[model samples]
Target: MKKLITIPLLFFIVFPARAQSSSLEKRVSINISNQPLELALKMLEKEAEVHFSYNPRVLELDKNINYKAESRTLDHILNEILGPSISYKVHGTHIILQKAPKRDFYISGYVRDGESGQEIKNVSIYEPQTLASALTNTHGFYKIKLPVQQKDIDLKFSKKDYDLLIQPINNRSDQKLSVELQKTIKPKVLTAEVSAIKTPQVKLDTTPKIEERLSSNSKPQPVPVPEMEVKEKKVNIDLSEELAFIDTTYQKGKDHFLNWLMTTKQNLHFRNIQDSLYKPIQVSFLPFLGTNLRLGPVVTNDISVNIIAGYTGSVRKLEVGGVANFIRKDMTGVQAAGTLNLTGRSFAGVQAAGAANINLGTSSGIMAAGATNISVKDSKGLQAAGSLNVALSEIRGTQIAPFNYATRLNGLQIGVFNIAYDRTRNSLPIGFFSYVHKNGYRRLEFNASELNNTEISFKTGVPKFYNIFNTSFSYGRPNKPLAGVGYGLGTSWKYGERLGSNLDILSSVYFQEGEFSYLDQHYRASLGFEYKVFDRLAVFVAPTLNFYVGYDESLDFSSYKLLLSERTSRWLGENARTYTWLGYKFGLRLCNKS
Candidate 1:
């Protein structure tokens, strides 16, 4: 009985130890066919009953692996799957995979032109396998860090207008290489000659055949040869002569209006019986019945004086007309007309007209018109019109009119309404409504004020200044809602990259329900700070000082009250016509221009 007990105790102790050791040594059967490393590891984890511990970045979990194991030990299977670059460690019940650390070294260099020895900027130096790249700076310096591997690394250098360079680096030691790149050579043009030869003439004789009389060993007489003549000729060509002829024909065909002006001047002068002597001064009674009207189409050096009207092909000095003056070509001197002045082409002198001034081409002098001034192309001087001024192209000087418009404005436009298709740094449109297609600012705002609770506002102008139009409705404590309209001027000052301040002055009129005649007027000045959340969206908060003037004493003032009641009461008398108070406004802005 003692021997039986000893045997059972020995078996019990040995069996438990063997089972505990065999738990970790358990065989796992896993078959993963071309799956991601993460998924394959998960399959192994389920079969082997082991957890994986690793940093995902170091494990390269996205890499694919094809692993198959049948009744194999987990350690053996892991060694078969992971290559030398990766290592694994087995703990109590976990498998840890990690990437082998590598020693890295740097490569720095300069790239220069082989011919001129000048540094080349923006050269790309890259390694294709690693997807590592470095660009040369302005000083043509480049530095790149690479891992120390056993295989050779290929680096490629390339730039525009230069030949490509590929270099091989074999070691991990830091290196400083100066590389010179050759420029690509352009192909040169070569001239070749082609000769033309006329075919030789062959004559066939059909006369009676004569038998040859010659000895068998003697040579026959040589046939008579025909003389051949060759001739060579050189041709001379002048391109300028052909071009001049074409230009003259084009000019004559294009100047039909000029021809008419010349014909009219000659015919009118002949009818007036003017002397053949060249006279610089001539007076005309009417457009075609003038002293200078008989002058040739283009007056070279003549001062035209017209009592009522004048017509000329081209004016050189001065033209004065009582009613109107018309020129077909260009006018170089001062032209003044009682009614209107019109030029078909450019006008280079001062032009003053009582009614209107019209120039089809460019104008360079002061143009004053009682009604309107129109220039089809560019204008370079002061243009003052009573009604409107229109320049189809660029304007270099000031334009003063009730309405001014230009394609490109390089100067100031002072009018009630101004429009510029292109705006420059110096182009300023100071008016009620200034619309610049290029550099103007436009925004839609929703604001709140003491007098106007909810206001919808439209603001437009340049970056420096803008005009505001506001319409608000207050429905707070008043028995009937009050509606108000306001006009204001605002200026902005930028403080930071996304912060700005705005100063505005506004005057508004509020009208009560069923009473259109009686109105309350309020003047307000505000300073606001705007924070731009996006390129097109902004939020603003402002502190305002308001002066309210009540037209009706019985109207309720509760709708136009603010938080600073204690400070406002000190200035408000018992029976005061105007009262001042502090107010606050918060709003959002949607900008159409940057």
Candidate 2:
């Protein structure tokens, strides 16, 4: 039984191995004369017991071929019948025929200074169109490969402070090419004759030139020169343009302790140069100790992985850090951090962090944080945070947090407390309390209704939607009074400058005999017509529909002017009674226009 099992297992494994062996090793016998290449290949395929795959256009199947083979390896027979450009690969019993690619052409040599005849390191040699590049080693040697090209290919050599060099070569074969770079001309510094004399006062005629005059101007006679006052007047000069080529120094603004631990001054000097260089990948332990080394802050990378915190010029794809990530310029990709994320300029992708996200410039994507999110300039996306969200300038998206603030809001805000300083008509703030300082609606209303002798309500928010808090009181019998305090929402509309209408819905709990022994719930809806009497004052009258549910019959009904009364059935027990009424109210309102 053991021998039989072993034989079956061995047969199964051996058969698969043999079947998967290269089909090109199979022997074939064939003989054909004056046959088309297509027919010849078909004959060989049958003899070898293998399938052939090839592009007819590339294989020139119509070409005539005279071939004869006897018991020869399939590879040998095919090689003899095929041109040098055609190649083949075999898999099991199948064969794939393809046109062979041209050999890669290599350009390898040293880059040296033209004047000094010394090797230059770190010189960038690249093909502009393909972006195939190689950097010179310490010995100034570089080797780069280029694809097959019929025309002359141009390779560019660039280095900071050196003139860019482009060389063209038409050779298809590998070649050794060495070139020298020349230092660029120094920038021309402008010279200004600054004087220390504050008042050298020599008055002369103030008139346009005689030949260039558009209109005639009165010319004044010259006055005697006055004694000079030696007071220095400082003049500021901007060399941003002239010195831009050599200005690699980065702007290290207000310093923090992280600067000492994460970056070096020498690395900052290469920021300008590194800004022009693009790299595919960067791995860093910190800002100054990374794959790009001292130039980490100047280079934009496609994929960046930071063991701790990292600082880079920008990110084109994805960036992740164990602690935090700082970007010197704009980022156009997703960035994630364990603690915080800070971007210097605009950002246009998703940014998330464990602690906070701060953008010094505008942003236009989703930013989420555990603690807070802050945008210094305009923003146009969603900001969601655990604690707070703030936009110092303007926001055109949504903010969801415990506290949200913006200079101007053009979208929605949802939080515990929302504050927007600018009056934006399109903004909707939904929270426990929302305040718009400039053009928010606020009103103090004093009104009297048939059901209550005295009523006062305070409303605040935008005129489109606002919150209301009100209180009502009534004198029933001697020493027996009724009082209610409630909250509601209201909206208002204007017909013209001074005339408007409002709608409000409110609910309140009434207290009777200075005790909470019985439940008295009141519900009402009011529609009011208002007219402005002065700048900050208005008068209004409203028609109200009121509903009241009571449990105690001993509670006085003298204070209520009810139109209908009925005994309630089951919800609040046999003592419950329901009352409904139609009432009217007149009021004086002190409000700010919104």
Candidate 3:
């Protein structure tokens, strides 16, 4: 009987380890500043290099719009991508978009002296057609394509150093012309016999004979020619030829470094990491394989494009892989590590770890990990990732979760604040979002969440997916959490991924199907910050002030808004919002590729 019982327990235990474990994730981000509607549209259409449609007129809720662009969206995506690019006026329930200016297919050409055949180098060339333009090359050849509005058009040409040339074109002839550049004879040059006295280069245009002194003392050596130093005015002189600047050396250096990282895919281990934002830390290798392509601008002249691809998996641990810029911070109050952790990786944008770690004060980011850490935490850009921040204190915002932090609860999350009973409210069912950045802690996150009259809060700085919007809405039940009903929603605005503190205005009225006279409505406007406190932790605090306008007669919404925990270690998740008690929350969250 004992042997049979052991076999059954082993079967159930091993099954979960072999079953569903992880989900994959792809990410993209674009940042476009508030340029003019027309210009902004053109930039996105012509510069956003992604597989999406670039229709300024099309509006889809949560769909990928493949488009192509030439310029980089690096900075634009830093602070403004959480909302729509173009704002529209709402007509009742409908939204009316602003109309954009019309453009033309421009036509442009050059003007050279028909006789001397001398092409103007600094020539002004314009097309009445789309206003597109180009100057003539040294060979006098120019190329241009215009968005012309009308068939009959006019092309204008004028240069500060050259005469103005205007030509009219009709259906009569193929558009082309050549005008002579009459020599620009200047007034100064025409007047010859330039006396050295006025040249200014002559500090003392001295000719004792040229001046007849009336002074009695002729021997007094005429007022010592005050050696006037006419500080030479650096008149910017435009060189006659365009300079062919060479950057071959720098390019070669950058290429060599990147090539080494790509080609030399040997297992590498790094120890003793001291970064600006976080404390000291270490990372190992989890041998695996995958691929990654980071098509963002190399603001750091280090490299332009980053491509990391490989696979990683520990002998008795999870597999890890992914490509990204590795940024770390120094650890404070160091604690010695217990045993060796597998960090060997072989993929792009991914990582995995499994082992007991002892971190006294450390900051790090890991993915696909099953770590039993005594005090190890996951913070990106200085902010935590969940509503019930496990150990650390101080957090803000709503609806954020670190994919599997609540994995111990399966699909259900059950955790709370500090184990000690402080005036600060402890366990409440709140969710959080921590920000992940390019190099590491360049930015942080803010999030908020409440459900089934349980604890729910938000913080800035978190992660999202490839060109996807983000949003989450949940229902609250005060008394019974397990039996209570719940609903949640997540979405993205505009193109998503741009995260900075911008006033977010969201309105939703849902009469959730079922009993309980459910009409939930809220108006919350909070300032958010994506901060990088240290290498290991980035915290974002937005003291929010919101108003609950809509009515739910069957429920006292305010009570749930300020949920308090009876036991300092845990409480109902829905009470995160309706109940009021100075609560101290800390988050320890994790995210993998997904």
Candidate 4:
């Protein structure tokens, strides 16, 4: 029973190997006059049930093959037809046919400068025939793997500001070659001046002749010489030396200290030493505890966990700190801190801080801070803070804070007060006071009303809303000639490019015969249509509703009143203290439009 089992196991293993070898060696009759190499290979593949692998670039696929075989092995036919330069090796059931490999070789070493002996980095070492290339590392070490080829290979080494070197190498085995390159000297152009004096010598005849002629009796004239005036030279005064006498020793020291402080702050690396450390995960008891570098000058990690604080050169994924998180260069992922989150360069993704989020450079993602959010250069996303949001350069999105300030804005600001130093066209400021230095609107208007014949109004604010101050003087009226001052609010709505409408409400007190008494008070509301005749000039007409309150009979409404002809209605108990009338107004305005 044991012999029977062993014999069956041996037959099962040996029969498969024998069958595979027989399949490779078996061949059939193939008769073709001029067939493509691919078609001929396909015939062989069908008969032998095998696949062939070779580099298509090295094979002539379109070439015609003419062969006739009768019961010849595939291996014998391939060897006789494809020549000795091409060979085949059996790997499992497939046959790998390729150009015969010569010998494998490699070249590796360091590249340096000829004079300084300093290693050169980023030097390109290439072989043109094989298209194989390699670059030197920071230490100027390079290794190039070469395939089997001709005996000799030429390598070209090149870099900027250095002369290129081409060396011919024989590939017998692996080699270690160290090459030094020389610096190229640029030629300078030299200029020289050549003077040539080639004049022919000529003889001159010395002769003086005075011909006799009729002389007229005329007086000799005297020529007057003009006097030359001398111009005074200007002397330059040196104010720098004169101003040096002023005592600014304390100011100089203060400025020096401030500059030093800024430099130190920018150079404050979290790691104490400069070395490359890539950690997949890091955990710290405190900011300084469990850290290889005392400060951690250059720590790059995927994730970081801190008990009190976290300091790293850069964080790629996530960093959570109990108190604060400070990054020296850039933080690309989420960073959360209990107290502060500060980045020296750029901070992308989400950043949340309990106290403040400060980015010294540009930021593109969202920032939420309990106290303030400050970006020194430009911010392209949202910044939300409890107290203030300050962008020194420009903001492209929204800013929400108690107070918002930006140098230039292209977004929206929602706060108690918003201020932009430059003009902003796309930014809308929604606050109690919105101040834009270059885009504010101011106008002076002269208007005439039924109660006040002549009035001068000053309007100043943003284009959408403005404050109005008006003073009016009326003469030739039924009552006494009065002067009054009023304060109001006005807003504008655009109808077209050069036309708009305005709504205004105002209240005023009139002074009668130079008396400082509030015996008469006037309230007016008007809606007007404004058209811009010129860039700085506009005209407006409005119908107004006026209410008058007088202690005595000092209310007037008689001249050119468009409406409310009757005054018999005692709307407020028939007393002279209160009256209402309808009127119309016409005005001309001059202002700057943003």
Worst window of 10 by summed lDDT in candidate 4: 265-274
lDDT of 4 at 154: 80
lDDT of 3 by residue, 472-541 (tens): 3334334222222212212222223323233333333334436444445443444434333343444444
Clash pairs, model 1 backbone: 262-297, 269-294, 284-290
lDDT of 2 by residue, 195-268 (tens): 78787888898876867664646586699999989999899998887666433322233123224434434233
Error of 3 at 39 (Å): 74
- The TM-score of candidate 3 is 0.17
> What is the Cα-based lDDT of residue 397 in candidate 1?
92
Residue range 11-126, candidate 4, lDDT tens digits: 98888777668766777666756998878888888777788888887778898999988888888878766778787777556888889765667899999999999998877676
Displacement of residue 561 (Cα, Å) in model 3 is: 8.4
Candidates by lDDT, descending order? 2, 1, 4, 3
Candidates 2 and 4 compared by lDDT, better number = 2
Per-residue alpha-carbon lDDT of candidate 1 for residues 229-271, written as tens digits (9 for 90 to 100): 8777778787998889976775565455434544442433323
| Deviation (Å) of 520 in candidate 3 | 2.5
Residue 413 of model 3 has an lDDT of 19
Candidate No. with top TM-score: 2
Between candidates 1 and 3, name the one with more favorable lDDT. 1
- Predicted model with the maximum lDDT: 2
Least lDDT summed over 10 consecutive residues: which range in candidate 3? 267-276
Steric clashes per prediction = 3, 0, 143, 5
